[model samples]
Target: MESNKSGFEPKNIWIARRKKQLRSAIIDLLNQYHEVPKEWIDEYNNHTIMSGSIIDTIIIIKESSTNCYEVQFGNGKSGSIVYSELDYEFQLFEATSEVEQVILCRNKVGLTKDKSFVQTMIDWLTSIGFIVDVDNGLRQTT
Candidate 1:
């Protein structure tokens, strides 16, 4: 066989920077407009969407004094919780997708699944924040 001149190697790109910018943008949107429940911040910070996947968006929330959370959106048509096969409580998928529509050659109207997953997640975390711990007084979800 002929001697190879150079080994196969992948090219480097500025994907991380772009992702960081996107993350910052989403965070700003949530922080400025979305009423994110504080309890979900930690979980949101600790979670991230798989790179190279068709992720719609990601948000970072501050759950507690020392915790941050990450909320990711996916390409699905609606919100669907994906559970782990091994552990029922272990969430594997929390992302949601925007909706689309088809016309019938006439006047048509449509609506996408209102980012309900995000609101629901915030609600759940907010509710969890009110839980009382027998040993540690009241504790947040983080």
Candidate 2:
């Protein structure tokens, strides 16, 4: 097994690189398809994407005090109730054939805390040409 400067195995490094590519593609698609605010996107790119964290999902929320948006990664379960007012949330997962499966939710504050949000996400994913299954949250059909 080959290792890079970080000492990560070749497969691990490849996975990391692939995740970064997928994250970029998802962000680009969001900008293309949605009317997302530039500040929100910028924060995600700078704080979340550039941080090199293996994030399963990202929640962009508007801070009540600052009135500015920020990126919160992971499952979006932790944080104060006020901070949980999510403006947007998206999950990126690997799919077969280099295409990434994306599950997106928008404009629902505290949506992540609700168990029913899974069904909501499934409905949205199916509407946009992704197949949801028990094992994999989503998969895109070629």
Candidate 3:
């Protein structure tokens, strides 16, 4: 196997470069999403997995009846709702812990359909080259 000047295998170097590209693409996607509030981006930029504080997963639950969206930021084990939107109007607030957030989301959208909501987001992330662990939510795959 060929090695680079840094003594790293070529395959390892390629993998590292690919991971960087995927991370950049995911960040770009988040920034372009209108529903993601500026505060979330600010917070994300200030932290990282290395610091033990990063927005590991983003759960967007859509209330079918009201056509509203509840956006939550998950850090693997727990999360909180950071933003919500209805009728094209949105509000930003940090309320409730992951347990409460889950109950609220279930009450609004029901548990039976919640997987689809999360899976859809996961699918999109995968399509964009971001590796996701369905069981643990999003993390720094690099």
Alpha carbon lDDT at 65, candidate 2: 41
Pairs of residues at least 3 apart in sequence or in different chains that clash in candidate 1: 41-61, 41-68, 41-69, 42-68, 44-69, 44-70, 45-68, 45-69, 45-70
Q: Candidate 3: which pairs clash?
A: none
Question: Considering summed lDDT, which 10 consecutive residues are worst modelled in model 3?
Answer: 133-142
Candidate 3: which stretches are off by over 4 Å? Answer: 1-5, 8-19, 27-47, 64-67, 76-89, 97-142
Task: Arrange candidates by lDDT, descending.
Answer: 3, 2, 1
* Cα lDDT tens digits for candidate 3, 10-114: 664565565465456655655443234444443443344434544444554333234333445454333322222333222222445544433323112222344
Q: Pick by TM-score: which candidate is best?
A: 3
Winner on lDDT between 1 and 2 is 2
Judging by lDDT, tell me the better candidate of 1 and 3. 3
Model 1: CA > 4 A from native: 1-12, 34-73, 81-120, 123-142
